[model samples]
Target: METVTIETSDGMPVAGLRYTPQGRARAVVVLAAAMGVRQDFYAAFAAFLAEQGIAVLSFDYRGVGRSVPVAFRRSLRGFQADLFDWAERDYNAALLAAKAWQPDVPLLIVGHSLGGQLPGLLPDNHLVDGILTIATGSGYWRENAPQLKRFVWFMWYFAVPVYTRLFGYFPGKKVRKVGDLPKGVIYQWSRWCRNPHYVSDARGRPIRAGFEKIRVPFLSISFTDDEMMSRTNIDRLHDCYRNARMERRYIRPSDVQAARIGHFGFFRPQFRESLWRDALTWIEQRTADRNQAQSAA
Candidate 1:
């Protein structure tokens, strides 16, 4: 893997890592990370896909990992980053970089959690060939698992607001939450999670309309043991992409022969043989199908 810098349309430079295949490449895969998760978290998965002949790009969204600006490193004082900036500036920059890197090859996204939802919001999303979503669901407290619902409510209504206000930013890392999150991101995320429909509710009709523009094939994987996302929650989130060809699959711990497969467990190195291999197969078949269609035309 090699480190590269990607410049967003707005002129901000973000850090990225590229994994190139040994020989000919089948496709270009973008590893879109979950909120507050660093790009390094996806490094192993990206390397695995690269070995399977796919060129992969794993990047940190602005305000996280190596992508954090020098100015914000000291403190988030006066920093005004938000979720919209994540979708518009960070993810867009990464996707644009990936697409430009291998213009002729198929461009695909392997999105985790919040990463899954933002793809539809990309204005140039038509350039993407397909998307695979993992453990992504509505962040609404009401849609969380029954056991976690109350805790989620407390986190949203009390913890997030109070903590963010007290610290100027969410001290997620210190609290052992997602990661240390920017104040703007945590505040906007809190607003969405508090709403019954999550992002759809907060942004309303215009955002829903943006989702309708997604026409690519989508494969969404949900874990039954994920305390954060119930099946209903996953469906509620994916439903925003009304025009997409979507397939939702639920995986249980028993199916994977594991004691537990929670929201974040899917990307663990241990699952590389079982779950990761299947993802490669999906990419291969999808690429073949697209090629055949193009040839037939």
Candidate 2:
């Protein structure tokens, strides 16, 4: 894995890591991370994919992890970034970088949670060949998993507002919620979660139009044991991609011979032999199918 810097269209230098296979790559994947989750969290998974002959690029959005500006390093107070920037700029940059890295190979995205939802926001999403979303869903609190509904309500109704106002940002690390986030991000995310339409309801954005524009192969993987994303939430988000050839799969722990595979457990190394192999097969199959279609055409 090589540490790299990706410059967003606005000239912000976001930090990232690129994992290249020793052999020629069959595909290049941009591993978009979940909300408030650092790119490093996917390091092990990315490396595993790399070892399987897939080139992977993982990056941090501007306000999180290595991309955090110097001024906001100590505190996110006055940091200026929202979910839109993360998608339009940071994620877009990663996609472009992956394409440039292996222009001849298939380009794919493996998005986790928020990472999965933002692909629609990219202006150049037409360049993508496929997307695989894990533990991704609409953030509407009302549609969340039963166990997390009330807690999500508390966080949205009370904690987010009070904490963001008091600290000039959502001190999630201190509060032990999502993780530290910029003021704009928490505020915008909270508003979306409060609304049933989620990002589509965001003030002036053409989010739904972007989703409709995506025509690539798309797949969503959700776990029965995921404590955060319910089947409804997952379906609601993917429903936005009306034009995509989309498929949804739900897995039970017993299917994978595991005790529990929650929202975050899919990427854990323990399930590597079982869960990871399945993901790799899907990616390879998608790439092969696309290649076959193109060759015939």
Candidate 3:
């Protein structure tokens, strides 16, 4: 595993992990994990891809994991307060950096959860050969969002407005080190529930249109019981991609025979092999078409 610190087009520093196979590569995958995820969570996937002759560039987002930026004061309002632009540009820069570092390699984007929605948002800009969105979604995207976030936002819409007026900004519930999330991310996310295309900047471009422009072949893979993304998000993604070919599977945790393939299980210690088997198999079947085309050409 090789490590490097690279800057995004927006200049936010991102830490990248490159796992190269022993021999020459089959392809390169630019991986994006769920929001708040670190690169280590994707170690198993990277290692598995590398073992299979595929190289990976898995990196930390702008403010997640090892790529913590010098956060500005939280008082900035509206667009200035949103980190979505920073995060999106960081993803693009990671892909470009991967190709720049390995010019001859074929590039495939593999995004999980929020990362899943990214390639569709950016579409087939020449930097990519294809895209794979795993357990990704459009907006209000808490897979558990309906029961969890709808309630929280109902509470926050009332509770937070008062608190923000008092505290200058509402201090969000902290899970891990993402302390005091700014209201802007939440506010924008709320708007996304109605309009996923609500982007304040070009870097934070909307995917609904780009989703239609995805000319590169795409593979949208998901588990039925993903904790953060519902099956509907998967359908929405597939429907929007004009030239996409999708393979959908549900991993049942209940059946003794069914793998314990929940959203988190895909990264957990116990279910690693099962998760990789599903993912690698999907990649193999889809990319084989491209491989054959290249060979024949």
lDDT of 2 at 57: 96
Model 3, span 107-197: residue lDDT tens = 7888876677666545224567777776766544343435444554553356546654555444443222223434555445545544444
The residue pairs in collision within model 3 are: 142-145, 143-228
How many backbone clashes can be found in candidate 1?
0
Error of 1 at 140 (Å): 0.8
What global local distance difference test value does model 2 have?
0.92
Per-residue CA lDDT of candidate 2, range 1-297, in tens?
999999999999999999999989999999999998998999899999999999999999988999998888999999889988999999999999999999999999999999999998898899999999999999899999999996789999999999999999999999899899999999999888888888854573436988899998898999999999999999999999989999899999999899999999998999889989999999999889888988999
TM-scores, one per candidate: 0.95, 0.97, 0.78
Decreasing lDDT order of the candidates? 2, 1, 3
Q: Please tell me which predicted candidate would have the highest TM-score against the true structure.
A: 2
Q: Write the per-residue lDDT of candidate 1 for residues 21-108, one digit (tens) a residue.
A: 9987899988889989999988889989999999998888778889888988866655667888788887888888888888877889
Q: What is the C-alpha lDDT of each candidate?
A: 0.85, 0.92, 0.63
Off by over 4 Å in 1: 201-206
- CA-only RMSD, every prediction: 1.5, 1.3, 4.3
Q: After superposition, how far is residue 164 of candidate 3 from its true place, in Å?
A: 7.0
